[model samples]
Target: MANNPNENEQAQIIHWADMTADRIIKQKGDKGQYVLASGITPSGVVHFGNFRETITVDFVARALRARGKKVRFIFSWDDYDTFRKIPANMPKQEELKKYLFQPIVDTPDPFERDESYAAHHEKNYEAQLEKVGIEVEAIYQAKKYRKGDYKEQIKLALTKRQAIVDILNKYRAEPLEDSWMPLNIYCSKCNRDKTDHIKWDGQWEISYTCELCGHQGSENLQTTSRAKLPWRVDWPMRWVFEGVDFEPGGKDHSSDGGSYTTAQEIVKEVFGGTPPVYLQYDFVSIKGRGGKMSSSKGDLVTVNDVLNIYEPEMVRWIFASYKSNVDFAISFDLDVIKTYEDFDRQERLAYGLEEGNDKKVAMAKRVIELSQIGPMPTVCPFQPSFRHLCNVLQINDGDIKKTRVFYAKDIKNERDERRFQERSRCALHWLKNEAPDEFKFTLNRTRPALDLTKAQTDFLNNLHAFLEKEWDNLKSDKELHEKLYEVIHSVPEFEPMMGFTTLYQILISREKGPKLASFILAIGKERVLGLLRP
Candidate 1:
């Protein structure tokens, strides 16, 4: 269980500004300034799985800045990477394949006829990061670094191209056998760089064909090489070109002898600079029947899906709740409901509306710490239950503001309010799947239908009468339970315990529920009698 030193500090961990300053001091050792960099490819809608890396890098950046160190945090979008394939559930399928080799920034939006698909994906993710409080100077790879902005480095790579090939050979890895192209070959057909055959003729001649498109090209091995560098070289090359100090990547690249290791060596050898410190983050698995959310699989749960159910802050809390290496699970279940409730309870305590227990205080601190961001908009007033608000307004024919305020006051805490809001939004879901018209309220536990004997029917009638007459007198749970028990005891034909079981079965279909007395009180004696009458 390795812990992050920044988070596990014994004393009050200083602010993010202070942390950044401290890291800068240590990394530079009295040097001038340092820059932090992170990047992601806009291949698909940015899912929580993809966010693991982005959030980890953002946290590191924040930590560095907190320490009074000058830091430049840059987030690069690898939009120039070719579109891979049309994901499932995307509105258009075969139509999008035409742009497979083009940069993602040049692709058309699947949903819209006019907008480029790359812009569509980029716009959504930019908004998501804003919601999550991640601020970074964005660089689009297609625009910023394209047209050979890294021409010098590319030239260096070409000069030491043989050296890189020698290193690959040392590792027993064979270079692509084609002769007309440079060592690195990016297929114009697939838009992906994984191609075959890089054959070298004499000192300055090589060629390769796109394994995907079969398009072939030749270039001088000297300065006229048109092939892109392999990822193993490209990644470290960027670290040197951009002066990246720290960047976090997925565990795949962070493995014991993965590309990052090779890239680090190439960065030192080719670019004469050390690669950035790397933090490896784990995957996020979605709960229920769906497979693990994946951008490549096109079965991803995007940040928008979470925002639909949770506030921006709660979403941030999820990112901060666990360390980078530990995989975590998110469910649309009772557990999620409980988490929202707990967050609300803690929030109430923090705001001084309730008695704060130590646990509540700690939870409150966690929520606030994770959600720290710029000032929240005044326009986005907390709406506890979107469905409830919609329903109350729909039924009463009133403004949403009135309903929001009413529900807000009743919520007791922020987390509970959020839970109720989510549940409310799911009202239509439960109604469609679980609820029955015969009973307006769905029973948590279903009871099988039972035949009522003559004696049972008569006893039920008497019980109903007793409840109808005593309904108003039953002011509390204790009073209701006592009256019901007394009536059962006085009935010679009815055993009190059996009668109680019969009553519970007719109502809840279970032998147990909330405190029986409290349950009856909450539903009211009249409703209970109506439910029990034969």
Candidate 2:
């Protein structure tokens, strides 16, 4: 087995999501009619980790469509599920405690913006999902349940309750009790599903007593809207009900005897439907956050926060460019600049402006294609390195126009202009919040803090004279940079770094700074000469 991807890899390396989609198409046998489904409980603030699920389905759906297979990408909000816990950020905790056992869709929105608590959260993330270019049919589980859309499925689940219990027992160490029902019934009087005791009144009505409030009521399984299947039964029921062809889940659900396993069996045996193809994706953790995120806790890096930092394309690239099962950390510090650089490098390779292996080029191209949230310019926008942009902004003291003029010599059109401005804003934010100490530097104004030797002084004077003569005809920063290298090598006593050190001491009274040539160019030739000359 080859350990490296580029080594001994074939001409075309299939992307993991594409491969999964392909298998789904072949198994389902309807290339033109396939549904890819993913859902999240709108129980709290949507976190960045939730994006893994959204983007996973989005990529696979896009890949399927790219192959001329029609796909209906559906994102379901499981809001009909009972509100089990109080979120950390929710206001009116005492007021909300009474509504805990009811469906989130029934609970009033604490913010009073939307119709219900679930609608409030769903509407927020719905806008965010649109921003990231996820074109999916957003389904609210409460509406579907209340409208009796899952009436047949609910009835079927009730009939096959014994079979579901048997299936769940296979994945559990201890057997389920004889009284365990696959469905939960809310009390008709209290509208709360946290009922401990339930009695089947044969065929249609089921009586339940709410454990939380001790409210007792009976509901007709045929006409009443007080029943919901538990997650283990509900998951597979939905898979069969919606005809889901493909879905991906986190590592925990993919573990042995996890909920997915139990659901798989229920779908196969009880629902009499083949389970959708499963892709087990890894978790995304923040650098300082100790473990995986639970959005309800409210300590999270939201998807919108990440979008504010990274371009939409680069944000999509983070997931599309990697294998699903490989765990990755999202660092907020200096690594963000490196991450942007990596994305740009891969993009260049994909566009054939840079050299890479055939398989790598193909993979890169596909990653970029899927990474886009919307159409991009035909010619890639010229971008200075993110690190360079950061330092140049600081050097210019956040004068965006001055920094842009210094960094980008040719702004082709509005697109290039817009891209440059956007990148500058992102870089400025990163520097202000997440940049590490090593990358931070301030240009010295008043000098004379250096103990320069006679030889170093002579070298600085000579380099100054050299720059005065050659700076004008020097077309670019690259040309000036090369010229600096030539001048240093001509004096065999000085090393490459020593040349930079000499320049830094004279100009900024520091040991090091930005690339000498670019820094000098950005500072303007006249300003640099004034500082360097005696």
Candidate 3:
């Protein structure tokens, strides 16, 4: 185990786990066993922001395993926390309002069928992790850990409680407002914890009445205890109790001189134990949408929402492309298409399908393989923008006509079938949202009566004659536009620009759209001359 490995040193570090394991071994010697942990309070729908912590931990855990290190990754649900105010979107707010101060584990599952509310939220997030290939042993705090699994550690802190209290009191006295209560106990009666304060009076202490519920009784903090250690002590206490080696958390806990730092001190002081190695991850910011994706705010985009537009591999690539410190953005717009294009290009370079001058190609290839996509395509040449694909699909009635025809005609290109399928789904979603009206062509029943004045009639006749004669010779869109403008300019009877506009409107309106010159040729010179005969 050594200090942080350089890029040159990175090559020597073959697997991510080996790099992490080496670091752990350096810190704790050969006896160090690596473990990963991510904890969440199931206060709302588990949004993508919450999932970031899970994925971050999973990446490290997988990397450790790749390095031939034994890794145990566990997730803890903070279900024992009292239910706060009912979230706004909750269907039955009034009914559940009564359970606000009780442990979430004791509340009935909002969905009714689930065993408990905590279980319902836990299952929802667990399902998402499974979908994203994130694996972890789940530890439910309310059930397993809180039922005296950590009783010895809890009692140790309780006996040495004065020391913990002194630290908190000292913190509170400081001008920086760094202090917090050492214990958070929910009264079995009024159920509120924050508003109530406890005062120790020798062997016996009197409990104050809750201002809201007005329920009061005499109680003992040292005896008949139903409280957990405060967050600062609880965090490090868990590390000591579980013998955890590594864990990642949001900046709130991991910030400079924050709870994590303070907890490290308490762990060594009260428990006489070493704390785990900590990686502080920053928040992922979404584009166009201000602020982080939050479950409580109900402003979150779920993992399922993202999977609709992108392949799982591409989504993972988006995460792996950046280091944890940088804040990033994800959009469901044309930008998503650009991301896919970038992923495809990188995938090609990695597999030697495309010539590239950079050694990063090997790293890209490693990511591609890790993401589990098959070998790169050999003959598939076209890579359209997501917006372009959407437009094409829209014009083809969501049929993806060009891709389907290409695949059908090229039997040898069958190796790229899966790539086409994945892209087609992305195209379908773009078409559905962005260009629904143009996805399919349909004809109208009746044509509008053309009531042109004498000058307008003559211009139409001249335009028809010009198109019929030069239709076959026309080569490009620019050429066709120039030809149409020439007719409009020479014929004083038509307002040149208006003539081109009218012709375009008529063609699209009549034929559901027509090839510029071909439709003029099809309608014929004699019919055009007669229709314009004012």
Candidate 4:
């Protein structure tokens, strides 16, 4: 993981974010201000698969600011992109088919809540980003285009049409014709891009015949509201438009002959602008679903879905913990519990409450610094075992308020109480929703008829007798745990597993559960002895 760093190694092993920021400043030169950009086409619901780009830029932006560099982080919603297909998850699938080939911004909202399909998806995601502490100057391509905001850029692209073709065809198996223009003109009449037989009249005027509605007209490229550059041209064109210093792309765009390859050439040769310092980020897959997520498929997790299980800080931690180029999975499976545990460990290291080698401490501090949303605490944040919360919440019958009351004595401060509240809510949600059956339990209403061996029966009987008589003497969970172990070894052939399983089955109707001694104490000595008595 190359996570830790020694004093000498700190300079050598910069965090991926700080390293990337350094590279950007070196490549672009130290300017008064720098622009970092990201974007996605709102063709459907924006899933966490797309959030990778947004968070990558945010990390770099923070790193740049840490070095006292002025940073402008902008995210674009390419809502003006064509609606090529109806996603399977959307409603009115059959009706939406008729809207294909139009701008996504112009399509009907399948959910019928927002102004258009693009706004519906875009607005929801913008709010989600704010929840996780990412702030960006959001540029909506549809609104910009409809307002003719990019007409000047469009005119520049039209002037370099042939040069753009030359760069693109360098990688294309077949050549693009000289007559090919660098723009798509949506038919102003039908408002659909289902048009062909185009002709560029050389200067700020292009004529096209609508294949769908049989309309023909010349659009003044100098003033038209429907002109759009192809992805390759638009990508570089915008780099110049916004003076972008850094941007990250997916593996699809970073390949040898991918959009980025040609875009770099087009930016330099055609647009006379340098390409941004670019990094290629790997894909995010769902655990147990070993494939890339697609918005069109809708079989993917969103940022909200993750937030439902993890606190806002933990959400940022998961993404910041990974290098941008490393592929990772978002787990809604058992790994969720471990993820929480790992973050809590990082918190301990960051606060110096837990000891680590210098390198480990440095890495943990950096990750915690990046992962935090508000001010860093002077002390260690309260550490809660996510697995314990699951057990405790279930033992409380999933009443979060009641569960909070149980942990109130342990919470010493306002911050710790908030931590407990957030974590318990997330834990209960997971236990009820995504947690696998093996991790879940319920107090048995009546004991299951168990065919217990004599040794198992004797172990339970002895433990029951001790708890019934000396329960008040047990001062702490750890002390009770040792006492339980002492009792288990007293009976001959009463293996530790045999005794533990016997008690678990009699109480929770499961062979496995939370740590037996701690869980028994949590269930209360009286309640547990009621089940264990012979």
lDDT values, one for every candidate: 0.62, 0.80, 0.63, 0.86
Best of the candidates, TM-score: 4
RMSD of each: 7.0, 3.7, 7.7, 2.5
Candidate 4, TM-score vs. the true structure? 0.94
* Residue 524 local lDDT, model 2: 75
Which has the higher lDDT value, candidate number 1 or candidate number 4? 4
Which tens-of-lDDT digit does each residue in 201-289 have in candidate 1? Answer: 54556566777677786656344424555567777888888888877778788775577767777888778998776667788876642
313-393 per-residue lDDT for model 4 (tens digits): 898888888888999988888999889888998889878888887767777888888887776677776776898888878
- lDDT score, residue 387, model 2? 75
Candidate 2 lDDT over 1-534, as tens digits, reads 124657447424788878887789788886567989999998877788888988999999988888888888888899989888888888878887888878988888899899988898888888988877888898888878777777778778778888888878888889988877777877777778878667775477677778867888877776777788898888998998889999899987988889999888899878899899888999887663356677666577787777767776777899998889888987676678779889889988878888897778888888888887767567776766787788788777877988887756667877678768878888887777777765666665555556776656666677779879878888988988988888777775778788788788776667777788878877777777777775
**Residue 91, candidate 1: alpha-carbon lDDT:** 72
TM-score of each: 0.69, 0.90, 0.72, 0.94
Query: How big is the positional error of residue 4 in model 1, measured in Å on the Cα after superposition?
Result: 22
Q: How close is candidate 3 to the true structure, as a TM-score?
A: 0.72
**Order the candidates by lDDT, highest first — what do you get?**
4, 2, 3, 1
- Best-performing candidate as measured by lDDT: 4
